[model samples]
Target: MDMSHIPDLITPAIPVFVITIIAEALWVKRQRAEAGVTLKGHTWKDTLASISMGLGSVAVGVGWKVVAFAGYAGLYHLTPLRMGSGPWAWVLLFFLEDLCYYAFHRVHHESRLFWASHVVHHSSQHYNLSTAVRQTWTPMTGWVFWVPLALLGFSPEMIVTQQAVSLLYQYWIHTEAIHRLPRPVEWLFNTPSHHRAHHASNAVYLDTNYAGILIIWDRLFGTFTPEVERPVYGLTKNLSTYNPVRIAFHEFAAIARDVARPGPLGQRLGYVFRNPAWKPKTAQAPEAPPPVEAAHPSP
Candidate 1:
C-alpha cells in the first residue's frame, strides 16, 4: 500500500477534534455545576487514558494499514470487475462501506477474538467526547472484513478513504451532551442516542446498535435499540486499572489463558473464537480408592 497516494481524511480533523473536546469539557463542567451536581462525566485520568489509547491506535494504524491495503488491493486485483471512481461509485460505497461496518462491528462483539481488540474502546466508564477517540491497538484482525469491497472492485485507496470518513463520522456521537437529534435524522443516521445504547453495559443494550454512519443498517438488521433509560457505560466486567497497556491487552490476556487450558482441540478453538462469556467445562474429580487404604491398615 502506497501511503503517499492514499487520501487521509482523519489527520486533517485532529485540530477540530481537539477544539471540540475542550469546548465540550468546559460545557459539561458548567452544566454539572449549574445543576448543583458534581461533575462526573469527564475525569482527568479517563481523558488521558482515552487520548493515550487513541494515540496508540494511530501509531499502530500507520503500520497496520499496510496489511489492510494489501488484503484489499489483492482482492481488487484478483477480481475482473473494476469499479469506476465516479460520484456514483462514491455514493454506492458510502452505503456499502457502512453496511460492511455494521457486520464487522457486530462480529467484533459476538466473537471473543475480535472483542479482545475492541474492548479497549469500552474500557472507559465515562460517556464523553474523549471516549470516542479511545480505540484499539490491534485493528489488523479486522482488515479482512472490509476486503469484500475490494472484491466488488473498489480500489484500496477508496476503501481506506471511506473507512476514515466513517471513523470521523462516528467521533461526535460519543457525547452525552446531545440528547437526541431531529426525528428523521435520528432514524436515518447513527446519533448520540443510538451510540449510547451501543456503549451501554445494560443487558438490553449489550450488543445492539452496531451502525457506523447510518442507523438504517441497525433498523434493517433488527439490532436497533433506542436509548430509553439512562445508559450505564463500560463493560459488564469493568477493569479496575486505568493503565493503557492493561486496557489495551487485558482481554487478549484473558483469551490466551482460556485457550491454554487443558481441553480438546475443538474446545480450545472455541475458547478463542466463541463468545467472551463462554467458559470451558471443568473435568470431574476422580473418586478415591477408599477400601484399599483400609485393607492395608487391617492387614
Candidate 2:
C-alpha cells in the first residue's frame, strides 16, 4: 500500500504543543511562586534554546523522512506475511510497536554511538513541557530501529502512526507538575514520576525507566525505576552550552577523539559502542613505599 497519504501526525499537533507549553509554564511558575521557590520550570534562555533545537530537528528530519519512508515501504513489499489493518491489528500493533520503541530507547541509552543522538532530549537541566520538543537533529538514523516493524508485515503507515502516537503520549510526561497519578495508572503507564527518573543523572536513576508510552516494557525488561525524590535532570556530566549544534553533536565528536587516541582496535570500537561513561582501563596506583623504612617505625 502507498504510504504517501499518511498525514504527518506530529505536524498538526504543533499548535497544541505551543499552547500546552504556555499553560504548563504558567502553572509551574505560579506553583513555584506560591511555594516561594527560586528555581523555575521555564527559564527564558533555556526555553529559547529548546525551541531552537526543536526547529532544527524538524528542519533536518524533513529531508531524511523522504528516504526513510521509502525504505520502510520497500521492506514492507518484500515480506510475504500481511497484517490486516483491523481494530485487533491496531491493538496488536500498539504493543509490538511500543516493544520496538522500548528496544530503540534502551539501546540509545546503552550504546554511546546511539546515545550521541538520543542525548539531545536529555540535555535539559529543567523538566518542563518544552523539554519534550528539544529533540535531536541527528535523529535521521532512528528509523533504522523501526524497520523491523515494516518487515513484520505492517505497512509503513501503521508503524509510523504508532511511533507518532508513542511520541505524543510521552510529551505530557516530561513535565514536573503532574507527578504521580493513581496507583493503577502509574503501574500501567509511563507516568511523570517514572519519566523523571529516566531523565535524572543521579547514579541510582542512571539508565533506568526507558519507555515511550507503556511502563510495562521497562518493568518487563528490568529497566524500570520509580522516582524516589526529585531528580537532578540532564546528563551525568551536563553540557555547559545550549548551542543547538553542540547539544546535538558533541558526543559524536567526543567519540571521534576517543577513537583517534592511541589504543587497540577493540578499545577504539568500545569508545563507539560502549557506554557513554566507559573508559579504557588504567594501571593501578603504586602502593606507598613500605610505610617508610623499618628504622622510621622505631622512631
Candidate 3:
C-alpha cells in the first residue's frame, strides 16, 4: 500500500473502526445492564454524530492534503538536511512527529480560532470508542505546525505516515472500555486514563494531557493530570444539540459573532487569536467579592 497518501492509511482502517465501534456498542449495552440503569455512555444520536464528523474529517483531509503536500514539498526542496527513510530515520521522525502533534493539540485547545475546529471532538458528552473518530473538518490549518518537520529533512510522505500511526494509537484511548493498563505502559504511552483526563471538563482536568502517542510531553510540559475523580466528559460549555452541521461550525460562528461585536481592533484580534476562554475587558464583569464573613475571619 502507498503510504504517501494519508487517506490510504486511514481508508483501510474503516472496516476495523466499524467493527470496533460495534463491539464497543455491545460493551456499552452490557455495562448498562450490569449497572441496572441507563448511563451516559453512548447513544445512537451521539454515535451517529461522531461517525458523521469522522467522515467529514476524512473528506476534508483528502481534499486539503494536496495543499499541505505542496507546502511541505516546497519547503523540503529547500531543506539542507536530507533525511533518509531508513528505520533509524523513521524512529527519529516518530518522536519528532509526535512532539509536533503535542504542540498542535495544545494550541488547538489554547487558541480560539483553532479551538473552533477542534471543539467538534470534545462536543460529545459521551466517552466511548466512537468519540475517537469525531475529528475536525478544518484540519487543514493544523498542517502548519508540522512544517518544521519537513524543513528538518523529513519527507512529506514520511511525516504523513507517522502522523497516521500516531492517530491510530490515540483511537483506543477515547473509550472507557479499558480502565487502566500496566503501570509502565500507562506512564510511558497515552492510554485511556490519560486521554480520559484530556477529554474531561472537570475543573482540574481541563486543558491538560495533550499527548498524541507519548504521555511524556504532557508530563514534561506540566499539562499532565491524573484520573483522580470520575471525569465529567465533554466541553465546559456543552452543546445541547447533536446536529453534525452545527457541531462542525458552531464555534466558527461564535467567533464571528464575538469578533463582530463593537470593539477595538485589538479586542477583535484577540477574539481570533486568544484563548477560547478569553474575553475583552469590556465584555467581562468584575467578580463579586465573597461574603464579608467569609472574606474576614473572626478574630
Candidate 4:
C-alpha cells in the first residue's frame, strides 16, 4: 500500500472542481435563478461540510487501500490499472468501476445502514456544481460495495485509480450548465438531465437514477426516469438550518431520538436500520407530497 498514489488519486479532482466552478459562473447562474434555486441560505454550511467530507474521504481511501493490500498480501500483489499507450484496459476499468458504483449507490438509497452516510450528500436543498462537492463524512459501515473487484483479484491501486476516474467523470454531470447532448449520448451517459431527476425531492423521482458514469444501469434496473420537467431539489422534509454540523448529523440525531423511545430491542434496532423515512408506530408521519413530475424539464 504505497500512500504515494493517494495524493495522485485526488489530484485529478482539482481540475474537475475548477472546471465546474467556471461552468457554474458562466452558465448555471441563469438556470439556477430561473428555477428559483438559490444556495444563499446554505452555501457556507454546505461548503464546510463538503470540505470536511473531502478530507475524510481521503483518509478513508488511504486506510481502505492499506487493509486491501494487507488482505491480499499472500493471495495477490495488486498492480495499478494503467491506460497510457493503449487505453482499452483503462476503459474497461472505468465501466467496471461505474457498474460497481451503480450497485453501491442503489443500495445506499434502499438500505438504512448505507443511507446514514449517503444522506449527507442529499441533505442540501440547493443543487449546483458545489453540491457535487458536498460528500459523505463517514465510511459507510458494513457497506463495502467494492469487494467484488477485490474478490476478482484487482489490486488496490487499480481499484482506486478506476474509482478516481469514475468520480472525475461524474463531476461534470453535477451542473445545470450543460443541457442535453446529441441524440444517443443523452440516452447512454448520466447526463445532467438524468442526475437532476435523481436529486429531485419529488416523490416519483425519489431514489431513482443511481448510475455514476452510465445511466444504462438505471435504465436496465428500472430506476430510470427521464427528466421531463423541472426538479424540486431538496430532502422530503427540508432542513431549514444552515449549520453544517446540524445538516451532517441531523439524521443521526433523529435516529438516536427514535431509539430512545420506549420499545423492545428489536424495535429499537429496526428504527436504526429501517428505511430512512421510516418511523416508529408511535411516531407521526411527516406530511409530504406523493410522486409527481420533476420541476426541471429537458429542453
Best by lDDT: 3
Model 2 agreement with the true structure over 201-225: per-residue lDDT tens digits: 8888999998888899888989899
lDDT of 4 by residue, 140-229 (tens): 442367766655556555666677677777777776656688769888999888998898888789989998989999988899998887
What residue pairs are clashing in model 1? none
Cα lDDT over the full model 1 = 0.88
Least well predicted 10-residue stretch by lDDT in candidate 1: 290-299
TM-score of 1: 0.91
- Residue 135 in model 1: shift from native, Å? 0.5
Q: Please give the distance, in angstroms, between residue 79's alpha carbon in candidate 1 and its true position after superposition.
A: 1.2
List clash counts for every candidate, in order.
0, 0, 0, 10
Q: What's the CA error at residue 216 for candidate 1, in Å? A: 1.3
Task: Candidate 3: list runs displaced more than 4 Å.
Answer: 1-7, 35-39, 289-299
How does residue 172 of candidate 2 score in lDDT?
90
lDDT, candidate 1, 95-140, per-residue tens: 9999999989999999999999998999899998899999999997
Candidate 2 regions off by >4 Å?
A: 1-4, 37-40, 283-299
Residue pairs with colliding backbones in model 4 are 204-291, 229-295, 229-296, 229-297, 230-294, 230-295, 230-296, 230-297, 231-295, 231-296
